[model samples]
Target: MNGAVQAGYAPPTGPDRPAPGRRWLRWLLAATVAWAVLLAVLTWVSVRDDPPTVREQRNLAEAGPVVDRAVGELLAAAGDGGAARLVPDALRRGCRITPFADGATLTRGVEVLLADDDVRGLLQRVADRLPAEWRAGVRVTGEGPVLRADAGEFVAVQGRSAGPGRVRLTADTGCRPIGAGYRAPTAGGGSEAETATELLRRFGGAEGPVQVSAAPCPDGTTARTATAVSAPSRPDRPSLPGTLSQFSDGALHVSATDELYAYRSSSTVVAERADGRVRLTVSTVCRR
Candidate 1:
């Protein structure tokens, strides 16, 4: 047995051995990489449980449907007296989805007509209205109130007050490999054509074109909106007051002026003069 005080020279097994700290550092790096792999695998397995289908397999192009559905949920949460539109923010900036490849994200927006004071109430309503599975909640921040939730299929939903009398809701798909480019989902069918024709005739202006868009409602109904532009403003405009009188029964009105008229009758209608042309819009009103 060698004693602590043995004065013999120690035998060398090799040129030099790795430092203990260096060996531990190597293990640390290996464990970090293994932990990352495990996290990725767990994410994949969890996504498979999301209803409808697994969301991670979808590319930016294929994620449109999920985003559109999320928009519907957001709008429905805003209640029936809201006029909303898809204000897309299709900026796919660069991100590192993996060490070897660049990734991208898809963000779509819904711009709703919200008064300044309505911001808080609306955000709270959305938090409550979103599906129970989403774990929706609202938190006040330095900027303002931010409502965030999970829209199934790996989509994140957020709503914030954009400006006075306006609120913007966004659905975002975090970073992912740029599997394919993006294509917007097509709007559903609605009777916007017919309404556009009638409204144009009433305003004594011919309809140039009509664009219709529809989204699924929280109540399992298809909410539709139709808009069209009329020719140059006509002198023989139908009496704005007289025309709206028909829908005046038990309806809510706003912005009644010679240039702009907005109200919620059987549906929500807003007519305003834009660039000397009258642009009219009708949005679906779901009666709670």
Candidate 2:
């Protein structure tokens, strides 16, 4: 009976005993832990040293100071001859946020209403006067020669000819969610405002639309500018350039031509007459 084996046989507790999927279960557990560890490592690698996810957000208001600083520096570099005014918002309906999301972008800048016909030279002067890190350079285009540079911090600065005697410089912050709209800084008429007004009166020009612009400087100071245009006016002497030449009381003559005049004393004052309109622009550094 002992030699006649049973239909099925099994070992009780010995080396010959089956572990019953114990090894498979242990392998499965090990594989699961390894996969989890790999996932954790990948995640850590991706987000290491990254800033808190805040949309890299900058609204028009937040970006105004940056643009103003750039514009101020640009005006300073362009000498005291060109008439400059700040364009707080240049992007109109075209201000789109991004390709992957819904948002808006704001661009701010200064427009040179009066400039030398030598656009190339004017652009070159501005390019050289700016911070060397800006990598400013002039490139030729069909419309005219243009100046472009990276003003650091993702701010793109560019200068181009707008018309026969017009040039514009801009610092653009590509795109961001319109966190907040721009609120222009409150500014009063600086001391130069009176001078600008006096010059206008000397030319028999009546004050028209006036725009005041302000920007922050790198030294924790603010630069301010005031611009006024006239309505078909003429000087007592009948010659715009000649009338300006006689104003040598305290201002240093910057430039004088048939259609334009510039003087700089404590502030830069520019007068340009074209198409029966006289435009006056005044700029001062660190006024506020």
Candidate 3:
């Protein structure tokens, strides 16, 4: 038996070994899978814990009845006694009210159209009606006269011009959110101006240059405005420019040039077409 060997039989040595390349590939595949899983978990955590965006806050404020009720209460209070004499019928009829929230602050504003002189009188009336606590801070002057009163912590009353014949009266109350510190969710888009330019180039079919500029608001936010003129594809069928309606339903990732802070909000689009030329303007607010 030792002298005779079975046909095609060889002496056994050790267990079979995988080639080096195969081993390396296996390790690489495992690493990739682990990395992907880790990334998914982090993303889930981020989204779950992220604070609501400013736009979301604004939407909530707009939809909620609290602001409306506040406005109604203020109006009712003003209408009481002889206050009705101070507010004109036309002003009352044209009144518009909006309530919004910024961070922990809740703001409700009422706007009315009136003559320049009427605005002064209305402000005076409002000042007189404000609570005693707000009276001391109340100041009135010419050149866009404003009446402001500090009610309490992060709460105040304001009266200013919405435009030439428009006056806006607003009240703000701040109630900071309690508990864990909030972190603003990252805005997904790059530069808002760049995004606007790209969208215009892709859709506008412009014949000349596009202009983009940044305008800072009194609030800390910045507004990026992009303008372009598009040539008509055909003489009879003029080009229709961009519009907010186009992007209102879509989630946009926008950022600022200076701060590079990004946010996800719908880009405000405005478009006009005339005389075989389409004028498109896109603007979006970027949080610093």
Residue-by-residue lDDT tens digits, candidate 3, 111-133:
44342336666666666765576
Residue 281 CA displacement from its true place in model 2, Å: 1.5
Deviating ranges (above 4 Å) for candidate 3? 1-73, 77-104, 136-138, 141-143, 178-288
After TM-score superposition, what is the CA distance of residue 256 in candidate 2 from its true location, in Å?
A: 3.6
What TM-score number comes out for model 2? Answer: 0.65
Each prediction's Cα lDDT score?
Answer: 0.70, 0.68, 0.45
lDDT of 2 by residue, 16-64 (tens): 7548687789899999999999999987876685432432445555665
Across 185-250, the per-residue lDDT of candidate 1 in tens digits comes to 455666655665676667765556677666666676766667778887677765565665565567
Error of 1 at 20 (Å): 26
Local error of candidate 1 at residue 203 (angstroms): 4.1
TM-score of each: 0.65, 0.65, 0.29
For model 1, give the 10-residue run with minimal summed lDDT. 80-89
The number of clashing residue pairs in model 2 is 1
RMSD of each: 7.1, 6.8, 23.3
